[model samples]
Target chain A: MFQNDAFRALDRQESLRLLAKVPVGRVVYTRQALPAVLPINFSLDTDASVLLRTSPDSDLVRAIDGVVVAFEADEFDAATRSGWSVVVTGRATVVTDPDEHERLSQADPTSWMPLRDPVFVRIESEMVTGRGLRGTRGTQ
Target chain B: MFQNDAFRALDRQESLRLLAKVPVGRVVYTRQALPAVLPINFSLDTDASVLLRTSPDSDLVRAIDGVVVAFEADEFDAATRSGWSVVVTGRATVVTDPDEHERLSQADPTSWMPLRDPVFVRIESEMVTGRGLRGTRGTQ
Candidate 1:
């Protein structure tokens, strides 16, 4: 997995592993035909789908449903100049199945805020890519 | 400004101020008619333009030049459950003028890795928006 001396390319499994490590990521979607990004806490489903729980009336729910969006999560340490980022690009769809919703509710995905009527938006991990950067001292 | 009990909306000035506090952000652009996001180190120019220095032949330069892109930066504390995020939407342009490039070169924007021949991409702050999340205990 070669990229450069400083950055190492990560494969699909490694990318999904890192994606599940972070509890939050920024969701990129089209707003008014232009791109907009919002940081949201998400849970990685067993199948690698990025699941977002938010209020039913939230703007994010309206904008991202059935849309091809990108979800990115990373952890970077400026002091060490080391970090890894994973981006998942896929079509986001609202989870409307009763059984699946009940199963997810039992899993207890992390949420930043409690919503009275929470809706789940699941982003299929159709394309996953990631990279890790080595520190200046050649350590990650 | 008002958003909800958990999130507070920020004005343009405050948004830019918070945007300057972080060293890295995700750049969102369109790839093959689908949204793609890549984490990149950036510097907020004095005028609020997001400046990125990378190799001349980097894929980002080729993909984002003259295209509208979204840049997002945030600082989140999971334990505290508080953070601020700022998003800047604008068109990215490559710095081609000699005098302007000379001035920017002297400014020394932060770069994750040293590049032999660096090119500058400037994203104008055409639209800026931000939000702050209050901790569960009500402290930010």
Candidate 2:
């Protein structure tokens, strides 16, 4: 019963599943009271939270801690014009527990940047929304 | 003079140039005081503003109008592990003037969803930042 003929809305479970398939997403946060976005490598945790590993000294670590942020990932084929996008929005907190850090460091979520004393930031899966575009009405 | 070895920073002009190369990007805005992102087709205006055409009643139109939002576009090669992402932060305003609307409607910026009485939103090119990742140190 989708009103829009061009796209289909995705449920939370499907959205998280699509998110896990992508290696990177754009994180949206407030920088100096203005919106800012950066693309970073991320992983969908077992609980559906977004896990990001970055350098401890990076500004991203400082900006997102204890704040609400948005993460979005999508894959679109210009030729087929069909793709899906998933957005996860929630509060982000830095994981400081020594044991958890050790586990994550050993597991090693893929990083575009090399890791040396990395900081793990978690974005709770509080609100998830996504859409699948299959080009034209009959394409699906 | 780069602090991060994983990515190279792109200047504003270069970032704007890259923004024009893509047909789509994600727009970040505040939905009920939390961050929200949506992927949509867009074009870069001659003045570097981000132009979007969507249905007049779309939630995105209401959420971003006259507000500070972030627009991001990127291209990546999964096989080569090389890509660039550009983010534009500025105020978004709906173009209400009939003449201006007529001009844009005639030009018809690319739209993923077919346009029926589309509304034009302009995001100013106030702050632009980008990063280029060449995989590893030796790859670049």
Candidate 3:
């Protein structure tokens, strides 16, 4: 979480529910030896783990192996200038289990544009935290 | 610029403006042969250049050379369901010119947390584009 006083503590339940509802999120990974963030289509299974469908030859699939990755989804209310966001940090591993992979990619795994069958990468979150800006000043 | 109906044309002016107005943006880079995104403090200079000052020895600095980096900032107005975003795609190079470097670093590049020397990385943009989602229905 941000050290600034402006960042408010977000409600875990509400934020998690919102995150689960959304079909897409930004997957932060390391690309070409630098930090990169890309939009990913994923599903939050009953076990609270995330499933990402990506091509086996894709850079994202190759980069994330037993690495600590961050996945985030956020919504900000501009009129009120207040919003809540949730971030999940965990270890990312390629899901070799066929049955689990099928269930995760049952539908559109990505929200932006269409794609072919993507290799499934699962990020098992170790830490889940959220922050928000609330009150009058937050709406500014 | 987006191919969709909402956002058709984008230019440098709009991109620089949006880049300046937004408080948060993702700095894309390559790390461990993957793309990763990190949010950091940035200031816009009058010459349409974005300024970033980071610690000289950090992994972020070491990993930014010869890579196609993308820096993006956007704000969504929930009331109108509309907002504008600007993204700059270019290669990032470490600024070695002392006199020019001093001018940018002078713009108050201190961070909330401890970071020393403030090495500057200039993202020479190859393309500046923006997209506006106004009077829209689906997610931006």
By TM-score, who's the top model here? Answer: 1
Q: Give the interface RMSD values of the models in order.
A: 5.1, 4.7, 8.0
Candidate 3 global lDDT: 0.64
Write down the lDDT that model 1 would get.
0.84
How are the candidates ranked when ordered by TM-score, highest leading? 1, 2, 3
- Please give, for residues B1-140, the per-residue lDDT of candidate 1 as tens digits: 12267888899999998888788888998887888888888888888899988767878888999999999999999898899998899999999998988888888655767566677899999999999988864211
TM-score: which is higher, 1 or 2? 1
DockQ of candidate 3 (2 decimals): 0.15
lDDT scores in order? 0.84, 0.83, 0.64
Off by over 4 Å in 3: A1-3, A107-110, A138-140, B1-24, B27-43, B51-71, B74-140
The best-first sequence of candidates by DockQ reads 2, 1, 3
lDDT of 2 by residue, B6-69 (tens): 6788999999888888888989888888878888888877788888987778888888999989
Supply DockQ values for each candidate.
0.42, 0.43, 0.15
CAPRI accuracy category, model 2: acceptable
Q: Candidate 1 — which pairs collide?
A: none
Cα lDDT tens digits, model 3, B25-108, are 667665675445655556666656566666677677788755668776766554554566677777777778999887776664
Q: Give lDDT: candidate 3, residue A98.
A: 84
